[model samples]
Target: MAEKAIAALTEAQASEELARLAHELARADQAYHGDDAPVLSDAEYDRLKRRNAEIEARFPALRRDDSPSDRVGAAPSEGFAKVRHAIRMMSLSNAFSDEELQDFDKGVRRYLGLGADEPLSYTAEPKIDGLSLSLRYENGRLVQAATRGDGAVGENVTANALMIDDIPDRIDGAPDLLEVRGEVYMSHADFEALNLRQAEKSARTFANPRNAAAGSLRQLDPEVTRGRPLKYFAYSWGALSARLADTQMAAIERLSKLGFRTNPLTKVVEDVDAMLRHYAEIEAQRATLGYDIDGVVYKVNAIDLQDRLGFRSTTPRWAIAHKFPAELAWTWLDGIDVQVGRTGALSPVARLRPVTVGGVVVSNATLHNEDYIAGRDAKGEPIRDGKDIRVGDFVQVYRAGDVIPKIADVDLERRPKDAQPFEFPHLCPQCGSDAIREPGDSVRRCSDGLICPAQAVERLKHFVSRAAFDIDGLGAKQVEQFYADGWIAEPADIFTLEERFGSGMQQLKNREGWGEKSAENLFRSIRERRRIPLGRLIFALGIRHVGEQASLLLARTYGTWEAFETAMVDAALMEGPAWDAILAIDGVGRVLAQSLVATMNQDAERAVIDRLVALLEIEEAEAPYVADSPVANKTIVFTGTLERMTRAEAKARAEALGAKVSGSVSSKTDIVVAGPGAGSKEKKARDLGLTVLDEDAWLDLVGR
Candidate 1:
């Protein structure tokens, strides 16, 4: 509502908007300045201010007395001594495009009485997304430190600042009184580590680096502040008795020499094009960089030029902070719903008021688990600053790398009065089973086994999925429809569809969307898959921890269904060679072995499997790898054509045994398998001192 353009508003509409903006901005000011925890993202606050300015420009009389246009930010929070800065630490105007940057340059020229042809210089530095602080040094010793609250007055944090290792305690060749201004921030690695520690202690986890830094810095206990990993980057100074240098870049260099950390990306550029190019380069490296940066800040390089093109009411005329397009968006959370998985874990999803984020329309976001919804940890400790999301709360949703949706923060002030807490059900919604969460596990599971509709449906879907049976005419919608209409209940029932309904009085062809042709085609596809390979049959069973690789291992270990069943029966006795052999497969663990055996021993499950087996042909499994094979698990370079099998057959055979076949030979190549007419690859293999084997030798080793 706040981001709507001014040109789209009527006079009456503008008046209402002004009132709303005044109230929201005032609340945001209180949260940001007083709490040290901002409810709104900076981009969102900026957009609201921009909208207010635009509305006032279009309808001047509609502006209220409490308009946010006249204010810089909310007043300083209580508890710390207030320091009045000698020079006000002001914010910067924003430039989102190259044209805005070009306009900025043009405006500088007009103010300096210079023409477009003038060779003006500028300096660009990364605008670190962090808390702004000013450190005061007197008589070459650290004295005071304060935050940039409301631009003029700030809270003194000398004790907290003293704990930061990056701040110099004393300097020898310095001014009588020097005030160094910079950002105090936490790096990405530190933030992740902090979150892990928070999880262990059942404390609240921070949303991002900026929040972590701010929260750490504002702690009443200096001991808590001392424990946090904090760093500083000195960019611009506040008040200095002795001048460092004439130009911006030179001043930064001097600061570096004085043992202050400076951003290495800062550089002096000749024109606007260079500034844009630098911004692009920084944006490209944003994700890989250890710390967070909102944008690039550009300033007139020369001190004289900056003085000449001096202050606007709240910002400098000669500089601008070019912000990145927002990855985070504010939208109303509409409702919370639950989805039961094949593993019977009930996952909650937040249905949101549809909003476009980074070009994608996102309407649903994950709530993670019940603990996330209740603002607690595994032990029911508070988290996310103790903010529990209600249905009507306006929440900040961000996309990491523009793909994953995460709820960043909640605006508690905007939450409706009637909103209630989401009740994470103790009983399974899909089945009347007792939903149990074992100690130390995050997910709640249904104990009803195959009786649960959702779990059974999902298992059936997985059974016919592409990696399993992969019937041609079967898809998600068809499977869902068949499950709902009682046409299929288990994997075995699929084969009986034609015998039960084909050319009968109560026929499937009489259905609305499915006709004779479609039904016949579907039955034909089902018939084609009656003879499935061993690996596919094992995976289609959907036993816990039994994935494609584990299934392959089981299939290859026992050649036939009868042999596999007998081995599993014997393994269930708890002491046998059959269990040892199952565990001996390279990738198979005790958990998977137990799961497979337990699944096969269940009376109902075994009955289903027997019925399915009776209706189809189950092929014998083949073992491709043996311990005595010469090339077992070796990486081989296949160079030239073979006199016997084709190159494809050779590659397939090698891959089946866990051997990696490469097109080129390197130091890591164990051996080179060469054919009659060898090429440069064989030469390179010999040059690298790798063993070369002839086709006949390879064939003899594999018993071909």
Candidate 2:
């Protein structure tokens, strides 16, 4: 049966579809990018994203804030230091069909106001199926390497990247500063050899070359990455002090000349027909290619043309990835199982009869939420034609560079007579806690957060994560082992490990996989993390809604841990100047504000905080300052439409110059940058006798 068209969907239906797409895509992004374990195949993920785009196009007002179209990738994984990209590493829009490719070309011509017969050229190259890496060099020497995390920020993997033979440590003729972007991949031969080694060691093997490359490159220890047969192919560039080339093909040649491996199949084509022909040629040779090639990526050849095309929020208009067809197969749905996540959300996983899809054996797939199994969305809107999945039913499965396969459709005709509708549990399976779905939430959450083993163990993992205390020797595996052994229970227990188990008969050295030296090293790592930054300490608490950014915001707001604690204690009443102050923060809303205050006010949580505080030396957040800058350490408020730059851009610029950007105009505001259509904030600023400047005047003052 044909699926319902986007034009045919009601406004409510479109909204519901958008919500479902957001949830699924967000989870998929986190799994694939963050954990390096993808649950949904790329093809299915793309289909849902395409549907979301079509619906948003038809009903513009229904576009969501967390829209899939506006996002690039998942946030950086937890166990790595984050590096903000100098220039955002944008994702390319995808084209699954030749017609879509044609639309891309036509869209480019339309944007540039060119005729159909306009002379234009494009570079078509094979899109490598591997992790995206950005290498930063200064003075022709390698300085940093990062993963394409959420585009804006990425994981710092400089040491790991330096170990790859294909990457150059230095290039004498390069610009003073340059950011080379490309793919880090493993060959088919290497992947198989790696799996053999894993089997010999009784370790889990990777699902594919992509996963192997990602897992290898993101290892905490650089020596692990050095042992992996990893290679890099430089195809693009990010931040650069000077232009390397004037055209896409020329840039690739320049990168190749600069001691970087460039794909041999990359070619400049004169027209859309030539591009399609090249894509076909590449597809034919894909099997013979030593590495994985997902599809052909096409980009405008001329640099000037690309600049003219510009970019959308997430993707560049000048380029598109023409993906290969997805692989599919039919299999039986053996059963359905529920698993609780760190946040206590009950996620359903489908157990399928082992079958081969895309040359990989698959047995499990994600069911997203209970609503997904029931064949409906959160609002009870019909999905998959209202065909609920049941045990012992034949289902169509698809695979596209993913570890977990996706069930595309269920065959009701083949459903077993004894199979019944699967009942989603009302209680947490791990702890027997009441699992209640909030009014506006999609998934049921366990009420007993503190006592639940699943949540507790996950929180311990987060506490030792890269952005938190980052105890070098204490990783997720060690945390789990210690927790299960009843040696550690809370964050405070980690500080007392040396005292409790260092000298006794049950000493850490006596444990399996631990030597005297290794145990001492672990204790040293723990001791080293005793003096932690304020932002990291806040993020380590595992409070809901207090993420890295919010933690930093709170740290900057309060300056010191003592100030933050005192303010939170005062704000426990939930109504007062203290609470109002938290609500007034630039980016923090009432939701986050309330979460921080409530967590600090809880007696159990407060005790935990006190215990950790007693053992650790928390550092104060240093005020940002720029020499001779007028707005240095001053508060500035932006009001109305700024024609020169976006609000985000303005705020970033202000922050860069050591000026604090406040959302609302207050008596503390030193300057107010107001543009046309300035409203209440601007009026309030003027009434308060604060300095006011137009966009041009503000720009001039900043010397932009």
Candidate 3:
């Protein structure tokens, strides 16, 4: 129901809704945490609980049984080698009940040598049930991030951390060094959606949102982590260049100003009673919150006092985690389906008979991968009780603090006679292309290059996407329609539409769903995209390995399309300086370079490129804009680099910050970095009166 409708409900109506909500929520909880499979998605359950909360908030006295105020916590998850933390990340003491919380408060007061009547402020906030992370920012830029592995040591997750949209790539006006501590968690909605996608492709689905977040952050491929819907909440600081604030709440507020999403419920309470009240309030609000939290955390507000209170062997003496008890349920696994992703990875999704759990209906879950379907691990070892999930199997599903609805277990005794093992297609279902799984890779991929209809359509979609050509009146539908009609087979065909069909015996205006004005508008939209940046054009090509960032890197390195095309053609001929040049482009490695050259080597691809080039005026990529840098957007040269870094390293570093690093020092050269050898290029720079920097000076200039 709409919020307005729910709000306008009479007290009697609300009371009746609450009663139903109580029963439904109870069932959902049992299914999510019990021996039975869950019947509700995390989002569905959260919405129902949120609805219950909204109604209860409006009519507190009319609240029914099984309210969120009585709920509790569950157990918590992933990959990678370990990196020791600079400082130990201590855990918090646990307080399961109000009496425990009070005792913890008393312990804090007694330790601090404060009288029983004296006021001792504490910051109470929701303890998100996800991975703990420590982000180290150097000179206002994120440098490293790590997972809390063993308090004293953790796995480096810097690459994955950078992928988080919530974490800033670069912060303005920050300290020289800052170590921000926070939780990286997935929301209920994102978790459910993620699981559905996972199940659709027959991939390994996460048991809960916590596992999803943890696994995402620990992925060896940062690109994989980038795809996950992970979020960060900065609650505290481990190290800082300067003091953030005197109080914990104020420090969190400062982090908020620095672009961190801090919990809104954090408050400075005056006494133990306020802390308990806040905890109860937060618990009631948990179902409505998008993220999963086991309980409310309370810490000494004063930073100085926190330091004085010190830590125990494992947990901090000044902080405590007051947990709520956890919530599971039984559901039927009806069937399984597959879904292909943008790059063509298949995932398996579970189709379930609709069941009520936690007061909401769950009709689906994730089956994960082919191995999961066959009841085996990645190595084909027996798992899941050595029984494959059948179509009519009774699966145990659960939703903990995390909102993802997952199959905890499957009972095969009730397997239907019609049940059969799912056969994963070796060919892409959408394009008839061979879907191959490479060695050391878990996911399979479509190998049709740009020929597959699915890949082509997806490419066309990207070509006209907002970040690419962004042609108006030519969305995905129009592109697909045009493609199916054999009117626009490639990017260039889009530009040829007006000339070919603007006014003819078979005009676009004559077609169904097309009018004279609309057809003209479509042509106009295509015409507007005739001139685009080289980077955007490269990105629109939809090469297998190249992404937006990689496209931009190539564009910046070559500056012009002609230079880039020539280099690529040369590289395709044989491995030499040209291939090395492509590989030398910081982010571009041998594999990516090979993928790019392979695309260019195809005759059909080259012909398409020729047609596209003939139709448009491609602009040179703009130089990197390092606003505060001395060499940004400037043409420069490096000569006689005798120490510190290799010549290629210097070129990559300079080009990354928008400097044009040329092979030779010429009249156009803005500056020349001259090392101890003092070569002829250095002399030329002096003759030209261009600025010359020594190796040491150059290093200092870039903050290296």
TM-scores, each model vs. reference: 0.48, 0.77, 0.50
Worst 10 residues of 1 by lDDT: 1-10
lDDT rank order: 2, 1, 3
Predicted candidate 3 versus true structure: per-residue lDDT over 1-704, tens digit per residue = 44555666665455545544554554454444321244556544555666676777787655432244233211111245566777777766566568878888888776666789997899999999777889999998888887776466677778889999999988876678889999999999999999999999999787667767877777889999999999999998887768888999888888898888999889999998999899889989988998778788999999888866665434677898887753467877877877554455565678878765543456776565566677765445566666777777888876534344656677766667777877877888888888986653445667875677776776788678644687878878988888998988788888877677654315577788888778767777777789999998887886654655567778887889999999999999658778766654534644457768988888988888888899889999877587787778787778885477656456756765668666666666787899878778899899999999998888888877
Model 1 lDDT per residue over 77-121, tens place: 556778888788887877766887898898888666679998899
Worst 10 residues of 2 by lDDT: 1-10
> Which pairs clash in model 1?
none
- The order by descending TM-score is 2, 3, 1
Candidate 2's displacement at residue 128, Å, is 1.6
What lDDT does each candidate get?
0.76, 0.84, 0.73
Q: lDDT for model 3, please.
A: 0.73
User: After superposition, which runs of candidate 1 have C-alpha atoms over 4 Å from their true positions?
Assistant: 1-5, 8-12, 56-69, 328-332, 335-704
As for TM-score, the candidate ahead, 1 or 2, is 2
Residue by residue across 494-526, what tens digits does model 2's lDDT show? 999888765332556778888877877788888
